[model samples]
Target: MELDTPVLDDHMHLDPDHGRGIDAVEDFAHLGGTHLLVVNKPSWHLGVEAGDPDAVDPAAAGEEFREVFERTIKVVEAASDVLDGRAWPVLGVHPGLISRLVDERGFSPEDARDVMQAGIEVAAEYVADGEALALKSGRPHYEVSEAVWDASNEVMRRAFECGAEIGCAVQLHAEASEDMSEVAEWAEEAGLPAERVVKHYASGRLAGPIPSVMSEKERLRVAAESGEPFLMETDFVDDPDRPGAVLGPKTVPRRVRWLLEEGYEDAVRRAHVETPQSVYGIDTEATLSE
Candidate 1:
C-alpha cells in the first residue's frame, strides 16, 4: 500500500536477522517518510498474541532483543556512511522486557532496568546528543501489578532523567489497565509533555479492566488539565488481510483523520510519523541514493 505522508508505526518490529536491510529501509524512507522511528524489537512470539487476520502480509515479527540493539548500533553507525545520517538510530529498551529479562535472565529487575537506562542515557548523550534517543514506555504489565509497574515506571523515569525525549505506546497485551490518573503520574514523572509522549495503537483495546484510554473530550481534558501532551496513532500490525498490515499502511490513518474531524488536534500531530522522528533526532530530509 502507498500513503502520501509518512505512516508512523509507533511500535515497530525490525529484527536483526529478518528486517529490511539498511538500503531498503532508506529507500522506503526517502519515498516520503520523514524517517522511520526504528524500534529494535527482534522476532515475534507467534501463536501467543493474536494479530489482525485481514492483512495482505502478516509479519509475525518479535522475539528477543539481545541482538536487536547490537544490530541497531551497526545500522545507525552505517547510516552516516550509507544514507548520509538519515537513519533514525533509536536507543531504548522495550518496556515489556523488564520482567522477561528478570524472570529469564536472573537479574534483579532494578539492575536490569538500570542497565537499560544506562544504555539509553549513554546513547542519548554520546550518539546523537539526546536528539536520537526514542525514550519509550507503555510496557504491557504497566498498570497490572505494582512490582512490574514500578519497574517499568522507574525505567522510563530514568530514561527521562537522562534527558531522553520520551514516548510510549498504548499497547494491547496488558493485564493492568490504563487509568488517566496513573498515566498522568507516569507522564509527570517522566517529564514528557503529554503530546510528546504519545499513547498510540488505538486499534487495540487494553486487555485488562479498562475500556478506552481517554474519551475524545477526556483526551483534550487530559491535555488541558495537565498541560502536558497528547496524541493519537493507529498501531497497525502486519496482519495478512488487514489493510495496513505489514508493509501496507491504512485504516489507522483514517481513524486519526476521524479524530481530526471530531476535534483532536493533537491526534493530527500524532498521525505525522515524522514528529517522533524529528523529536527523537532522525534526519528525515537527508539526501539518499536509490
Candidate 2:
C-alpha cells in the first residue's frame, strides 16, 4: 500500500537485541511509517518473567530504569539515524512492576508509592529535558491480586500527577474491560487534561475522557464516527521469543492505508497527524517532511 501522508505508530517496544531492533525500525520505515514512539521494553526492568520485579533488588530498580532509559535513547537514536529523526521515546514504570515491588520486594504501600513516585519523577524530568515524548503507566487486569491492583492505581495516580506538573502526555496500558472513564477522571483530578491522556492498545467501541490507539478496522470505523480524535498503533513487541507478539511494526501504516483507501482519509489524517501533534506536541509536518 502506498501512503501519501506519513504514518505515526503511537506504541511499540525496542528489544535489546540490536539486530532485531534495527530491523524492526527499518521495516517500519520501508512500509511508509514516518514517525514512531518507541516505548521502553518491559523486560528492561521487569526481567524474564516480565512481571517479576522481585527478581531484582529494589535499589537496583532505579539503576535498571536508568539503564533502560539510556538504552532506549540509543535505540531511538539508531531509529532516527535510519528514519531521519522520526522516532521518539516514551519512558515510565509499568504498573505490574509496582505490584511486584509490593508483593515480592517487601515494600509496604507507602514504600512502593515512594519508589513509584521517584521513577515517575525521572520520567517527567526526561520529558521536561526533551529526552522523551511522554510517560507511560497502567495496571494489568489479569494475574494480579486485588491488593496489587489497588496499589498499582495509586502509583499510576502519582504518575498522572507528575505528568500534570511536567506537561507531558501519559499513555495507559490497562485492559479493555477496565473503565476508561474512571481513568480519565483520575487523570483530571491529577490536574492533567483528558485530551493529553492516551489509552494504549484500545478498540473503537471503548470511548472515554481521553483518546485511544485502535488497530482494528471496524474499531477504527466506530472511533471515526464519534468525531473524537484517535491514533493508530501495532504495539509491536520486538521480542525474539514472541516474534510479532501483538502486531507487526507495519500494521499501523497498513491500517492507515486501508482507511485512506476506504475513503476515511479525513479520519486517517485526524488520527495520524492532528491528534498526535496535539497530544505529544510533535510537529508532524516538520518531522515527517524532514
Candidate 3:
C-alpha cells in the first residue's frame, strides 16, 4: 500500500518481550505508514530498577536509566530497518515513575526528582549524540503531593533546558487539560520555545504547546478546520497483555487513507508531512525516498 503523502506516528512503542515489537512496525508500514517517533517506555518496563535510592550520588543512580534509553534507541534502529530513517527516538524518564520511586522505591520526593532530572540529562546527551531528536518529560498525569509536583516540574524544566541547549524538541506526558498555557510559559522561560514543546496524547489544540492528537476522525477534522498546526498519532503501546491498549498500529496510515478518500488530501498532508517536518526539523520527503 503505497501513499503519496507520508504518515508519521507522533508517539508509539514496540516491546519484543511483552508485545508485538518490530512486527508492529511492519504492520504500520504495511498500511503505508512512513515514520514513527518511537518513545522510550518507563524504566520499570525495560527492567531498569531504581537501585539504591539511599545512594549518595543521585546522578549515579539516574545512570541506570541509560539502559532504558539505549534499549529504546536499539528498537528504533531495528524499526528503522523496516521504515528507515523514519523511526526516530525520543528519550526520557517517565514522570509516572517518579511517584513509584517515592512511594514504592522509598525515594524521597527530592531524590526522585533529582534522579529523573539526571535521567533527562542523559537523554539530552543521546540527543546531542544524534541518537534521538527529542526529549520526553512531564509531571505525573495524576494527582500527587505538592513536593512531588514541584519536583516533577523541576524535572520537566530540566528537559526544557536541555532541549534548548541542544536545539531539539520536548514531548511532554503531562496532565490532560484544555489549557496548557502555564506549561507553555514554563517552556518559554526555560528558553525552549512553546512551539517546540509537544503535548503527547492530546485531544485538542491547547493554548501553549503543539498538540499531538490521537488519530480520531472527529478530532482530526476539528484540528484541520481550526487552521492551527498540529500532528497525529496512534499512541500504540503495543502491549500484548492489553491488546490495542490505546490504538492499533495501523490506525494512523489507515486514517490518513480515510482522510484522503474523504477529500481531505491537503489537511492530511499538512498533518502528516508539513507539521512534523516543521516540528522535528526532518525532511519527510527525503526520508520517504530513502
Candidate 4:
C-alpha cells in the first residue's frame, strides 16, 4: 500500500473493460491509489448516472435502487480481501437521476412533460396544484423548489440513515463559485452534511489545461475556510478509451501538487485521502504510500 503518498480517486464509473474486477482496484491501490469511491447509478438519483438496472431507461428514468445498493455491498465485500481495509465505497444518487425519481415517486410535483397524454394510464399519481394529474395528462409546476429539495433530502437521508448506508461522500457538478455555492446550498437544504460532501465534478470551467480565472478559483479558497469538510476531485478517469490515460500517468500527481501549491492543503488532503477514507469506510490509520 502506498500509505506515504496516497491518492484517492474518489469517483469512478464502471468501465466494462477497465473497471469491472477487483484486480484493477488492487493494482491501482498498490500503485499509490489508496482510496477509491466506486460510483453506481441508482434509479432514484438521476442527474448524472441512472442507478436502476431494470428501469425502462436505466440511464435516465432510474429503477429500483435498493438492488444497486445490494450490488454495492457485494462489490465492497468482494474487494475487502485485496483492499485489506484500504478501499471504500461511497453511495448516492446522481442529481438528474434523483430528480427523475422524485418526480416519478409522487414525492415532488411533476413537470408538465411528466404527465401522460390523455387516455394513457401509468403507475404513480401526480399531484399538481392540489390536483391529481393522471400519468397521461399535462400539468404545471405546482412545484415549490423547497419541496423538491426536501424530497431529495429525504431520499438521501434514508440512504444515510441505514447503518450500512455508505457516505461515499456527497458530490455535485458545478464550476463557478456561485454555482458551486449553490451545490453546497442544495446539499445543506437536502440534509447532507457539509463535512462529508465533496465536489468532484468541478469540471468544464473549474479545471482544464488552460487555467480558469483566479477569481473563479477563489470559490475553493472560501470553501476551505468555511471550516466545512469539503474535498475536490481531479476528476481523472483511467479508462483505456481516455487519451490521457493512454498518454501519461501525470494527471493525478500533478493535480494533487497543484492543490498543494495553491495553499489548499485541506482540500488536497481531503481529495487525496481524508474525505474518501472517511466516506468509503477505509482504514485511514494505515499510510498509503508505495
RMSD of each: 10.5, 3.2, 1.3, 11.5
Q: TM-score of predicted model 4?
A: 0.49
Top candidate by TM-score: 3
Best by lDDT: 3
What is the TM-score of each predicted model, taking all chains together? Answer: 0.53, 0.89, 0.96, 0.49
Could you tell me the lDDT of residue 222 within candidate 3? 76
Compose the digit string of candidate 2's lDDT tens values, residues 229-266: 88888888787778647888878878888888888888
Tens-digit lDDT string for candidate 4 (10-99):
445433234435655565545444544555433222222223333343223323333444454456555545553444444434434334
Which residue pairs collide in model 3, if any? none
Reference-based lDDT, residue 264, model 1: 50
lDDT of model 3 at residue 254?
89
Please, what is the whole-model Cα lDDT of each candidate in the order they appear?
0.42, 0.76, 0.87, 0.38
Off by over 4 Å in 2: 16-19, 43-63, 103-106
Cα lDDT tens digits for candidate 3, 163-197: 99999999999888768999999989989989899
Q: Which stretches of candidate 3 lie over 4 Å from their true place?
A: none
